[model samples]
Target: MNYVILAGGSGTRLWPISRNSKPKQLSQLVGDLSMIEETYHRLGKNQSVFISTNSQFAPLIKKLLPDIPAENYIIEPDKRDTGPAMAFVAAWMSLKHPNNPMILLPSDHHIRDKRTFMEVIEAAENLINSRQVLINIGIQPTFPNTSLGYLEVGEEISKEAGVHVYEFKRQKEKPDYKTAKKFLDQGNFFWNVGSFAWTPNKFIEAYKKFAPVIGDHLNELIHDLESGGDGSEAFSRMEKVSIDYAVIEKIDPRQVLTIRGDFGWADLGSWDQLFDQLADKADAEGNLVKANWHGVDTRNTLIYGPADKIITTLGVSDLVIVDSDDALLVTPMSRAKDVKKIVELLSYKKLQQHL
Candidate 1:
């Protein structure tokens, strides 16, 4: 199987620390190593791995993962959303390795149970070889998370290599709180973590059936690549929509299969989520500090900054304090998810330097 780690996100929710120049995947948010580095190590060595990112990040990613061959990096010319980005990847891979199955993995996710994670991935690969279906690795929802997408799973179809495969009924992208709670109570919904497995040809076919314009653009890209030309023109002409909106949600339920992954998966998309993931590493006062710190009454707070500067806090609780070189973000834990709005506000104010 060919593994492609998606690392093109701007990570706006983690802004100030996660900027456009250096996104969260390239930042040391969780541990000493960057998130992408952790993800690469988790996948293990001696496998056909690739990094799917934009041209701006190609050099940085290459410097970080020098072991990965130069030819393996799939660099998109422009910043299109996942729809065009993934279609471009499939087209490129189909031209190079058409027979191999491809798996799309996120570079910023935190998975504690690596053994179970690999087991599920192996099962997905086995199922793909045995059947003709687009596989989506769905996580068992631990709470009513309205921020994440939900997959409505149907009856069990089969069990391949100790992993239970189910029929994918439909997908609900970020439903309301009431709907999310109802979904949790129904016990048939799984969090869509954007992890998908399919052959390059199979994915191209799906685009052709559901999104003909994108399919047409993909063909043009494939042709351009064969003719010794970059696919920038074809990619720029494609729609800038997400994969869920363009194809995944519209695919025939019969042709889609889902695997339940209980691998302690958590998308560290926000500061609060990051805090939750590293909760076990917090200090006695419920403070998770990464900087030179001296706290008097800081409880249940996350202090992230450079080690050169000392961050002192007093009588602060349930807050997130991130001290970047150019910016400092101080927000309550409840409002950490709204940090993306700050990025938007900065853009609106034309403060590109800060962004």
Candidate 2:
């Protein structure tokens, strides 16, 4: 199957490390290689792969993803969410390979169990060949996660896919803690991983049905690009929305199917999530350090600084200290998820360079 990566998040929660100029996908937040590189390698083999990102990221991605042809990069001129972003991708792919099944992935997710992940992806890809359903790869929820979206499943489709295929009942994005507990109790909800598989034509049809305005806008821009005109202005005019809101949620329930993702997955959206993902790599005091550091009486704290700079903490507990060249962050681990607000405050203060 062909692949298209939605590489357009600003990654505000990551703050100084992930900024508007360089998103999280382009940063080496987890391992030696950047997140995007890891995602490319993890795909194993595919006919072709494309990355759709904002214009600021185009040149960087070009230099970074050398194996992918420069033409494969789709640059959104303005910041629109996944609704227009993905519609644009589907439109472009339909022009090139209408019948080919395509898999869409978010570039910034962390997957520890790639074996099970690929198995689920293969099953979803296979389902699209025989069925024209809009596929959503839903991870079985490990906990009551309030920050992420949830998917409710209905009837089973088949057990042959190495997973139980299910009818997608509905989608609920970012439910409250109480509702999340109820979902877990019902035992039918899954975390919406934002990965999907569908033939290009089927996706186009769904866009036409549920999100026609976005489809038209992207089609116009694609036509402009084909005729040697830059679609910068056209793209800037497209509506800013997400696929979940515009298309996925509105689709006929009977036409949607979900494959169970039993693999280890985390968006790593917040510092706490990152901490959990790297727990095994932490020190005895439950501190994860990615810098030159000397500490005393520090417990359950994280310290990240420039590789060459020594960051020392004394008598601090449950605090996160991240030292960049221009900015230093100190916050309680309990509020790690609120780092995105710091980015917003920076913008409000006209701290453009830091953002």
Candidate 3:
């Protein structure tokens, strides 16, 4: 099986520190290593790993993950959404390594349990090897998160290596607060972690059947690949839609299967989520500090800055303070998810340096 890490996100939610030149995946947000580095090392050194990113980030990702060979870097010519991006990957893999099952993984997630993660991947691989079906790894939801998608699962179909495999009933993409709470209350719903596994040919056939426009463009991509072309023109012609809307939601529920993954999983997409991931390391006052910080009455806040700068906060609570070289962000914890609005404002003001 081929493990392809998707690393093409701009990461606007984590602004100032996460810039256009260097996104969150390249930043060392968790520990000493970058997020992409942590993700790569989590898979261990034995598996066949590949990177799926755009040309702009390809050089930086290559620098970060030097262990992966040049041929393993699948560079997308355009900045299309996941629908076209994934279909292009399927086309490339089918042309190069046909019949091999591939797993699409996020490059910037934090997984606390590596052993259990590998076990879940092994179970998914086993199921994919036995059947020609798309497999999605579902993480047990810990909270009523309206930002993430939810997967409604049915009866358990089978068990692979102690992992319970369920029938994927349907996917609800970013529901309202009430619906999210209802999903949390129900025991059958799981958070869609976006980790999927299937053979390249199977996914290509899915595209051909459901999203025929993308499937038509995929044929041009395959032909371009065979004829030593980059397929940029063919890629840009496809619509910019997510994989869920294009193929996954349109496919029959019986055609898709999901496995329950109990391993510690968290998508560090925003500052609030990152604070939650590192909450265990907080100080007595519930402050997660990464820089030289001195607080008098700061509680339940996240302080991140450069090593040279000293961040001091007094009489502040439930806040996110991030100090970069050029920009400083101070927002209440409740509004940390709206940092992307600042990025949008910067883009509108033509302030590319701050992005």
lDDT winner among the candidates? Answer: 3
Better of 1 and 2 by TM-score: 1
* Candidate 2 residue lDDT tens string, 1-355: 8888878777788767788888889988887878888888888744388888877787887787788887787776667788877777776777788888889999898888888878777787788887877789888777789988999999776974576789899999889999998888889999998898898788878877888667667667778867766677666776788889988889898888988877878887877788878888999998998888999989888777789888888999888788888888888999999998999898999999998
Instruction: Write down the worst ten-residue block by lDDT for model 1.
Output: 38-47
lDDT of each: 0.89, 0.82, 0.90
The per-residue C-alpha lDDT of model 1 at residue 100 equals 79
Q: Which model is ahead, 2 or 3, in terms of lDDT?
A: 3
TM-score: model 1 vs. ground truth: 0.97
lDDT of 1 by residue, 1-355 (tens): 8899998878799989889999999989878889899889888954699899988888998898999998888888888788988898899899888867889999999889888888888988887887878899888887889988999999988777778889999999999989999999999999999999999999999888888768878878999988977799998899988889989989988888999988888888999999988899999988988888898978999999999898999888999999999999999999999999999999999998998
lDDT of 1: 0.89
Error of 3 at 27 (Å): 1.0
- Steric clash pairs (candidate 3): none
Ranking by lDDT: 3, 1, 2
Candidate 1 at residue 321, lDDT? 94
Off by over 4 Å in 2: 45-47, 233-237
